[model samples]
Target: MRQSFGERFDVPDGYLNTASIGIPSASAGEAVAAAVAGWRSGAGRAGEYDEYVERARAGFAALVGLGADRVATGPAVSALVGLVAAALPAGARVLVAGGEFTSVTWPFAAQADRGVTVTEVDLAQVGPRAAEFDLVAVSVVQSADGRLVDLDGLRAARGSGTRVLLDATQSLGWLDADLSWADAVVAAGYKWLLSPRGVAWMAVGPELAATPVAAGWFAGADRWAQIYGLPMTLAPDARRLDTSPAWYCHVGAAVALPWLAGLDRSAVHTHCVGLADSFRAGLGMEPAGSAIVSVTRDGAGERLAAAGVVSAARAGAARLAFHLYNTEADVARALDALTP
Candidate 1:
């Protein structure tokens, strides 16, 4: 119902593909520009860099309902997935949904060197067999289609010792998720978060003690202590598992979160889903759980783009993802473009 959310971005007519890469809000772009200017002028301080990192962590924590200490940063979702793989014991049986994004699947599969075996199962079957595996990893939403995984069922089926990891790339900003259901959550920020590329975050449950597979200087209790060749202690919390973040991403995400915090998240989600519903209805399709709507038509991507409607083609379907910036007018435009 709010018109102001769409004012934050300057997008093309019928631009609805937020699932692939979000158009950063105007404020986010300004923040990155300011950071670059500060660096160019030599006005940046070492302490300010740390402040940006902390600010990003706090921002993500607020979004996910987790303590700031529980959140950590990585260059990408794949890096965070690798860290989760490293924390598992060798020969651990890891269950994942077949045909998932490569970032989520390959990390655990690479653990084969550690005697770990990655088993791919249908998404529907993951919940029932979750107890049998040492770890169960899945996406909150499917990428190719907009199908949502059943989180409650998965949680109920989890055994006491079974660790659950979730790749929230497609769900975090648009859907309400209880991170408590998973031992660790990882997501790429360039999607629904409307952040710059190279920014992503991971949150670890307090009860889980995870070790990073590739620990860097940033993962230490005292980052600079080892410069003098002194004994070093790993950070006592989730910070210990952090990989070095892209500096610009920290600055941009830190600045953008405040603007995002100002908007009504629930309202924004409703607006997006409404747009998707309108599109599907106009296309003569059924309603879906999330903001992604797909139409299986040949050359669908080319047809849509020719009409000034932007979208992504995946698995032979033309996918359109609605974000807060999208309006009913945008959905109508896409539908008109798709009509033969």
Candidate 2:
């Protein structure tokens, strides 16, 4: 029998801060706990962690609808974005959405010394103006206010020969979209994927021709065998772009990701968005069709905290996110806190 989402997580009522960090499932928590216990007792083998890394890589591939060979493991999205930033030709024009998370924009912006100009446009305009730029980098969902990108517009822009790089940090776990067409896709595992910090993944598409500038031993075709070699030999696929695995993080992710991948994502999306819309309606706002809601009232952050409702303050608003573990009671508690 399948465990209910509520059964999988022991989240307390009034906890609504999934946008900042996710509560791990009971199984994942136990796996990490056991791994830590082994480490503390000097009973853990480093060699065993390689399997965990591979399992996590494959699970993320399944979630994003890609092959494991196209996915590269890393510790941070910024580091993976740096790999792509370094591959751009001198004088390349990069288009980015205004207010995009710096991890997606700063990497390309940092390359200005090489004549790589990163131009910021309204989030809505990124796709229509894509043909004018060499590359378009943006998040699947904006981090500040939860505005969704116009994916169809980006798809049309791809037809015009503009390469697209998407940061799915906010959307991957709940947003169901076919991302295989993009030149590259990157995500941090901690926020929505329910993994501990230090685990991330990047998918390199056929259209992206970026070289692995930060290749290390983990990037080798046979990393164990290539540990001490004069000539550097890297993996034939995206693994060549990998940073060394953070073993403990992967151990938890190996259990969490595959379990998440097996669930009916469409149902999960509906549950989350339904809760978010209910909260919006409570505040006399129309449904935004996103799982995240930003309340901009004065002292909203303090009020939520006072009411014991967990949320994040970002861009001058109190941001509340709904996930599978959240329920209607949480929305009511937050509304009670803010309205009264």
Candidate 2 lDDT, 1-340, residue by residue in tens:
1235634786777988888998888888889999999999999997889999999999999998889999999989999999999999999999999999999999999999999999999998997898899899999988898999988888888888989999998998888678878889999998889999899999998778766888889999899898886699999999999988888899999988888788798898998899999999999999988899999999999999999999999999999998888888899999999895
Question: Tens digits of per-residue lDDT for model 1 on 1-340?
Answer: 2335644676777887889998877777788899899989999776578888888788787777778888888889888888878778888999989888899989888879889999998888887888888888899888888777878767875546778888888887777667655888888888888888897888888655566877778888887664345465778888888877678888878866555655677887788788898888887888885898888977778888988898998878898999888888888788778786
TM-score of the candidate numbered 2?
Answer: 0.97
* Lowest lDDT 10-residue stretch of candidate 2: 1-10
Each candidate's TM vs. the true structure?
0.94, 0.97
lDDT of 2 at 223: 91
Clashing pairs in 2: none
* Candidate No. with top TM-score: 2
For each candidate in turn, give its C-alpha RMSD to the true structure in angstroms. 2.1, 1.7
Determine which window of 10 residues in candidate 1 has minimal summed lDDT.
1-10
RMSD of 1: 2.1
Q: How many clashes does the backbone of model 1 have?
A: 0
